[model samples]
Target: MKQLPLPMHLPARDGFDALVVGRNDHAVAHLRGLVPGAGVAAPVYLWGDAGSGKTRLLRALAEQHQAQGERIGWFDAGTALPWTLDEGWSLVVVDRCEALDAAHQQAAFALFVEAGTQGVQWAAGGRLPPVDLPVRDDLRTRLGWGHVFALQPLAEGETRAALRREADRRGILLPDEVLAHLLTHHDRDMAHLMAVLDRLDGFSLAEKRHITVPLLKKMMAENIHDLVPNPPPAP
Candidate 1:
């Protein structure tokens, strides 16, 4: 285990279970299986669409590894790569892997390949499927080598559960009617919903108002753009 100045619990910091509710179980389970089992050399690859919980799953994995006292290096492709060949051995959890160019991908693959032997595990999430991305044959082969898991979108019921859970965690009282109104009008993506919820929490606290349908209409209408689709352009 990683002996450190502080014993950080993976579940708490990562919000492991809370952030990834509904349709996250399958991918989470598959990634956990990667750490165990006598599998072929290589890190696990989680491929999914944006807001499909790929990044959340990756964080959960990295936190778990960190709790074990292992060093974990995170590479965010949204920004430039500070990664080099030497940044191995640590549990590598790279997000936005699809954003990395071909050359960088090859370099990352080479490092991960080495890590496989040194008892270093890697986990990464990518937007592009291996077949779709402009990648070297070797890198594609390596990415495909590990267990492939797809994070599916949350169902409507799952969506409701997620909303309720988020409200509870934030200690905000969101009634069912308000939730339904938000879900009906807003984008189906959880991230957007969460943002709206955050705004609601702030506005409600500011005004000392309860979160109800009437309150959501008055407050959200002021801050949020209409979720309803604009009328079709006149012919």
Candidate 2:
């Protein structure tokens, strides 16, 4: 029942259905088969850079399975231990696999070995693919035993579509030019990009103006300026 650290402000639509698959449709399809009674195998691995939505996918899959009365254990690789693979765990999802230490690696290997007999399904995620993981050779090999997918980051057009969807959800009218500017200069990840909408909403309300490129520039400038330490007066 453990949970990974996710942004507290996640949109209400944080589920597999909301995932923007861009080029990862095959991987997403395999993930969908992990549900209980789906007759799927274990060690489904997904790797991608940070903010590529690996954690979100893991969380979404875990949540879906849990809702169906299945026992699910979710963990961040750094603190996750193999001992948690106790009895009655229908699904085990480990995120941040690149952070696992030697001890955890051995434990993960054991889990992989016993997955068939224990009736446990495995889904692990990391910043890199299995062969590139920092775990032991045996464990790394086991991680790739089943479906291994490299979740692709959103393309420019995909990011723009996501932004438009989020803006519509927030009941805000975002001009195409403003969207283009943010897409061009700002962080391209959907998670971070979507988060900007909340701040924009607040700024627009306080200033009594609709969202515009100039308004976003002003807000961003103030945010950056606030991070700077004020200079000391001449001593």
Top candidate (TM-score): 2
What clash count goes with each model?
Answer: 2, 0
Least lDDT summed over 10 consecutive residues: which range in candidate 2? 1-10
Residue 221 of model 2 has an lDDT of 91
What C-alpha lDDT do the candidate models reach, one value each? 0.68, 0.76
Give stretches of model 2 more than 4 Å off: 1-10, 80-83, 86-88, 110-116, 206-208, 225-235
lDDT of 1: 0.68
Return the clash pairs for model 1, or none. Answer: 2-68, 2-69
In order of appearance, the predictions have TM-scores of: 0.77, 0.79
Model 2, span 1-235: residue lDDT tens: 3232233433556668766678878887877878898775757889998668788788878877887898877666566454556677788877788998888777766776676578788888999998888889988888887888888898888878877877777678999989988887776766667667767776777677888999989878977544223435778
Task: Quickly count the clashes in candidate 1.
Answer: 2
Stretches off by above 4 angstroms in model 1 are 1-13, 19-24, 34-42, 85-89, 218-222, 225-235
